[model samples]
Target: MYALVDCNHFFVSCERLFRPDLRNHPVCVLSNNDGCVVSLSHEAKILGIKRGVPLFQIADIVKKNNIAIFSSNYLLYSGISERVMKIITDTAKNVDVYSIDEAFIDLRNYEKKELVPLMRLLAEKIKKWVGIPVSIGVAPTKTLAKVAAHYAKKYKGYKQVCCIDDEQKRVKALSTFDIADVWGIGRQFSKKLTSFGVNTAYDFTQKKEFWVQKHFTIMGVRAWKELQGIPTINTTEINRKQSICTSRSFGATVTDIESLKESIAHFTAMSAQKLRKQNSIANIISVFILTDRFSKQEEHYYHTRSMALPVGTNDTAELILYAHQLLTELYKRGKAYKKSGVILSGIVPNSSVQQNMFDNLKNREKRSLLNKVVDNINSKSGLNSVKYAAQISTDKKWTTKTSFKSPDYLTNINELFEVH
Candidate 1:
């Protein structure tokens, strides 16, 4: 059997993790730049406040209703996610982290009598220890496990546990759920299914495999099989990332080439550290810059440029040089730039490559060793221990807005909040 565990109102839950007083109150976490609501608590949802509603539009409503708002604190959220997943992994024989707030675990080894209680215990432990409430669903397949999780969350006093081990319960759950609620059914497919009088999970499951495959795509076929209690997907262990990129919007629009170069260099250094963390090297580098469309100015621009390396490298200096070259080509002098980013692509595992044959530099080995030493020092001491000339400015105009942001709580000393 597979068990799917999903956290309830994840971002809101993360906020509440540190401030339990926020429970039973309307709370939301805003998106980057505090532009819109990205996550909302159940209380906020009950107030008819929908996700993605712009913050400015809902500011009056939020203030009048005494709603609590927080800026996105990814450092805290990611740290909490890692802790919660570790708890689930310790309990389950096998666990696959489906997302930041959801995971799938294999529970076939446990007896039916032992499964639900253990799942309930696990959920309670996570809530007690990690300050996140979780809903769990267990079934013969992953899709049904997802369905079970939805039901587990819909009604209270299920103790956050829903199990579909028996045929009767499975049939009843399928019959009550809408066709669109099924795991992989998109709106268009759901509409087509409704036309065929298949408006629920039961209706979709009742169709033959051949019919599902003929009318729908492979995804549909997989969902169909999963609904019929067949395991259509297998769990794979999560591996380290191949590439990482960090990009952000400017605090104010910038039009100068020097300021743009500074932003690109900072982002490039961050991306290089990320690459070094994965013990990988990039074969290509890309830089992108764009202007704000909302600026009332008629001249809006977006451009990206990428260059391939003569050989794979993870050297921050070399990466920044190439990034600056790309930025120079892409940046126009008079146009206002709102955002910029650097990406290191074509990443390969450290063990995948052989020494280059074409390069004739006698000090190539020395350069590689020096790069590794620089990475180690920067990683221990904070980012940019070794700075680039372009990023020498003490004040950065392109920083993100995080006025209402909570304490990092897990990372950063200066940003930590304490209640005296």
Candidate 2:
């Protein structure tokens, strides 16, 4: 059996973990730069505050309804997600994280345990420990498990855990479910399916092999089979990401090569850290710097460069040097770059990296050790406790405006939530 566990209004719930008074209140969490609503509580939905609605458009409504708004705090969300997943992992025998806010728990070992009751217990444990609510959907396959989760969320009778162990229940669940809302069917597929009179999840499974193949190829066929309670998709295994990128729009535009170098260096350092975290090494480093497209006075320009490393590495210093070289090659005299970022690709597991016998790169062991030390210091003392000299001295500066961001309560000691 497969069980999908999904957090309810993940971002809003993360904020409400600390602010208990906000429970059952109209609350919405915004996207980057607090631009649009990304997550909203059930109470907020009742007030007709839709997700993705721009904050400016809803200003009057927020004021009239006394809605509580918050900036997207990824640091807080990640911390809370970790704590919530720990509780889930402790309950289930095997698990696969589907997303930051959802995970699939393998329930093969727990046949002896009363399934729905056990799931309810797990849900309650997570709520009690993490101060966040979760809905669990159990079924014969991963796709159906996800459908069960959706049903559990929409209605209150499931008690936060919905199980579809019988074919009759499965049919009923799929009959009412829109084809578009199925796990793998995206917007494009939904439109095509709708045109073909496939309105419900059940309607999709009724299509011929030729029709499914022509529309979605093998992938849609997999979704079709999974809906029929046959597990075509492998839920137990995990696939490594093909590439990892770390880039952000600056709080302010930059004008000089030295400052752009600083931003790219920091981004490179961050990308390297991510590579090391995933036990991966990258052979290609790509950098891009762009000017504000909205600026009427300044001519628009986007500069991008990619170079293969002499040897694949997850070392921050090596990546910073490569990033600096790329920026030097791409930087113009006075472009007024608004955004810059670094992308590391051609990633392979660190252990799988084969050394080039003809190429001689020295001090690799020492560099790895130094990078590990810096990562450790930042992890323990807080990020940016230690940084490269180039990063420390760059006169070019940019800062994010996160006035409404909550404290990193779980990750940083000084920012820990306190009882007054």
Best by lDDT: 2
lDDT of 2 by residue, 79-181 (tens): 6787888888887778887778999988877773588999999899989888889999999899999999998998899999999999899999999999999
Alpha-carbon shift of residue 69 in model 2 (angstroms): 1.5
Error of 1 at 153 (Å): 1.6
Error of 2 at 348 (Å): 2.7
Best by TM-score: 2
> Compared with the true structure, what per-residue lDDT tens digits does model 1 show for residues 58-140?
88889899999999887678678888999999988888888889999998788889999999999999998988999999999
RMSD of 2: 2.5
Q: What are the lDDT scores of the predictions, listed in order?
A: 0.85, 0.86
Model 2 steric clash pairs = none
Deviating ranges (above 4 Å) for candidate 1? 186-198, 235-246, 265-284, 309-321, 343-356, 359-393, 415-417
